[model samples]
Target: MDKLAELKQGLEETWHSLGEGWRQLRDRASEALTRFTPVNRSRNSLEDAHSPPALASNWGLLAGDLYEDGEQIIIRLEVPGMVKDDLDLEVRGDVLIVRGEKRVEQERGHGRYRVRQCTFGSFRRSFALPAPVIAEKAKARCGNGVLRIELPKEARARGRRIEVRSG
Candidate 1:
C-alpha cells in the first residue's frame, strides 16, 4: 500500500508539471503570434498621417513612364475620359507642369455600391527637362485619352556627343 501511494503521488506531480508547462508554452506562442501580426486601421489612416495630403490624394497621376528622344523629351500621360480642354500644361524654366481634373457622374436612385478601387478629383504632375526645351513652340495633343507632350530642345542647347578613346 505504501509503494502504490508513493507511485500515484509521483505520477500526479509529473502530470501537473506537464500541464503547467503546456499552459506556459501556449501563452508564449500566442504572444509571439500577436506581436508578429500587423495592426489594422481605417482606410484613410495614411491620409490623416500626412501634414499636407494634397500629393497623397493624387498619387496615381505621378506614376507613369518618362522617356527622352534625341532632341525632345516626350511625356505620355494616361488621362482616361478627359478631353484636351480639361487639361492645362505649363512650362516654367526647366519644369513642365501638367494639371487636369477627372469627374465622375453621380446619378439618383443609386444605392450603396462596393468600392474595390477608387480614383477621383484633380491631379497635378510636374517634370523637369534635362536641357532647355522650347516652351513657346512646344505642342501637346490628346488622342484615345492619352496626352502626349513634345518638349523639343532648343537648337542651340542640343549637344553633339563626341566619343573619346583612351590612350
Candidate 2:
C-alpha cells in the first residue's frame, strides 16, 4: 500500500511540474506569435527543382521588432532563407501586415534529409502601429535575412517638440 501511494504521488508531482512549465511558456509567448502556414511558390526556370514531401512538423515562427524612431516607425523582422521578391507587405488602418514564402532549395536530386531543422513555409506577421503613418511614403529594404521597413509619420501624427525654459 505504501509503495503504491508513493508512486501515485510521484506521478502527480511530475504531471504538475510539466503543466506548470507549459503554462509559463504559453503565458510568455501566446500573444507574440502570428499564424504560419505552408505556401507553394511557383518555380521559375532558374529555380526549377524538386521538393520533398511535407512532414507533420512543417511550421515555424517569424520573429520581429517594431519601434518608433524620431518621426518614423521602423520594423525589423527575421526572414532567413528568403528574398525581397518572396515577400509581400501592406498596411491597413493601424496594423502592418507582412506575408512571405520560404521555399525549400534542393541542392541535389534524389537526396534524403537526415536532419531538417530549418522551417520552409509561408508566414504572415503583423504589428500595431503606435501612431498613424504615411503609408505612401514608407520605405522598405531587405538584406542579410532581415527585413527593415521605415514608415514615415503622417502630418498630424507627428508630435510637436516643446522646450521648457526656467523662469
Candidate 3:
C-alpha cells in the first residue's frame, strides 16, 4: 500500500511539471510572434489592397468604422496625434478619398536613440460609394484627433420604387 501511494504521488508531480513546461513554451512562442510581426507604418499599397477604397491610410485607416443607416452613411476615423488642418477630404466621381499626414517630434537627446516602434506617416484612404450621396451637403467634424464624416443620402436616388405595368 505504501509503495503504491508513493508511485501515485510521484506521477502526479511529474504531470504538473510537464504542464508548467508546456505553458512556458507556449508563452515564449507567442512572444516571439508578436515581436516579429511588423507594426503598421502608413497606408501602404500592399496592406490596403484587400481593404475598401476609403480604408487605405496606414494610421486611422485601419481603425475607422463605416456604418450604413438606411438613408445615411457614417464614417468615423480614429486619428491620434494629428490636427484638423493636416487632413484633406476629397470626393471624385463615386469615390471618396481621405488623406492626412502625421508628424512626430524629433528626440532632443543625442545618445543611442533607438526607436523600437514607429507610428508616424502620411495615409490616403478611398471608399467606393454604394449609392450617390449629396457631396455638397456632406458635413465633417474633427474633435480629439478623430475625424467624423456624415454623408447624407441623395434624395433623388433613394431605392426608387417602380410600378409594374401590365402589357
| Segments of candidate 2 deviating more than 4 angstroms | 1-34, 41-56, 106-111, 163-167
Which pairs of residues collide in model 1?
none
Candidate 2 residue pairs that clash: none
Error of 1 at 127 (Å): 0.8
Candidate 1's residue-wise lDDT over 25-47, tens digit each?
77654422211111222334322
Q: Mind giving the per-residue lDDT tens digits that candidate 3 earns over 1-167?
A: 99999999999999999999999977655422211122344434223324343322223223566677668778887777777887899877777788776664334343432332434456676777777788888889889978898888787656767899999
Best by TM-score: 2
Q: TM-score for all predictions?
A: 0.56, 0.67, 0.55
The TM-score measured for candidate 3 stands at: 0.55
Residue 116 Cα positional deviation in candidate 3, in Å, after optimal superposition: 4.0
Q: lDDT scores for all predictions?
A: 0.65, 0.77, 0.64
lDDT at position 42, candidate 1: 38
Q: Indicate the worst ten consecutive residues by lDDT in candidate 2.
A: 43-52
lDDT of 2 at 61: 61
